[model samples]
Target: MEKKIITISRQFGSGGHEVGMKLAQKLGVKFYDKELVDMLAKDGKYNADFIEANEEKCSPPMCPVMPGFSMPVFYQDLPSDLIYKGQSKLIRTLAERGPCVVVGRCADYILRNMNPVNCFVYGSLEARVNRKMSMIPEGLSFTREEIKKRVIDVDKKRAKYHEFYTDKRWGRMEDYDLCVNTDKVGIEGAVETIAAYVEHCK
Candidate 1:
């Protein structure tokens, strides 16, 4: 049997990560998300904080965060470019190893040659805001307005990162094999739908 890979690109507060995790579990495959960042940090001998901060983010032309000052000496070079290259390499390496569900980091584009099932998950603003609010800690105070702003900001950053790296429009339906609106079908339904597709593909 041929290996199958699922790459998910999600909007903030879209519950895409939850769906991806559930799908991977149901499919009995490995899942990659923040785990990829940790792996890169450990393998590259980079500060985890530095990798997290710059991962999926394009570098400013002016080098806003100077190494040995704002950043560690290990990150003195072109850190953003290195981060992109490192993660891209890791994504391809993992895909070659076996089947896995990779969330974001342009995994869809990175594994394009592998004919992976690329999914884009998005939700209505109202649904996204509610989802974000529900995830906040009980004692934490976050208004709906604040959550909405956060969602927009995060989506914008993701779009910019995708465009910068792949030159493809983020969340665009044409770029994906499946485009799901979690607001309509809910997370569990979305997972079931994608899982069925995966099974059929096999």
Candidate 2:
């Protein structure tokens, strides 16, 4: 049987991870999300905390002010750059290993040569906020406004990270093989739709 790889890129509050997991299960394949972080940390001998912090974040520009003049600063390496390299390597390695569903970390771009099916999952802001808030545990106490802000912040970070690493706009429909609107189709519907697309691709 030919191996198939599915890469899911999602908006912050969209249940993309859940959809990816369900799709993988329905297809009898493995799922990779936070597990990619762990694999990168282990394979690259990087600290887990550092990898978690730098993953999907763009490093701030460094500027050093000098007395009477500003000196040009050139950076050989940044933590975000290192993390991206490690994670990219890990993503490609995993693609080579077998069929699986990988979420985020620019897996789509990394596995371009493997003919992975790239998917983008998104939802309306109101729908996303409601979904996010529902996931909070009881007594966690996050207001709707707070959830909205968090969703915005995360989406911004993800967009920046994608542009920085892949030089491509994130969430653009043209870049993905499929774009699922979870708010419109619901999670199960989105999963079924993507599964059908994957089958057709094979």
Give a tens-digit lDDT track for model 1, residues 1-202.
2348999999999998999999888888899998987899888667789998888777765435555586543433466778888899999999999999999999999999998999999999899999999999978998889999999988998898999889689987899989999988999999989987777774
Give the top-scoring candidate (lDDT): 2
Off by over 4 Å in 2: 1-3, 62-73
| Candidate 2 local distance difference test against the native | 0.89
Residue 164 in candidate 2, Cα distance off native in Å = 0.7
Cα deviation of 76, candidate 2, in Å: 3.6
lDDT of each: 0.87, 0.89
- Tens digits of per-residue lDDT for model 2 on 132-188? 988999878988999999999999999999999896799988899999999889999
Model 1 residue runs over 4 Å out of place are: 1-3, 63-78
Error in Å for residue 5 of model 2: 0.7
lDDT of 2 at 72: 43
Colliding pairs, model 1: none
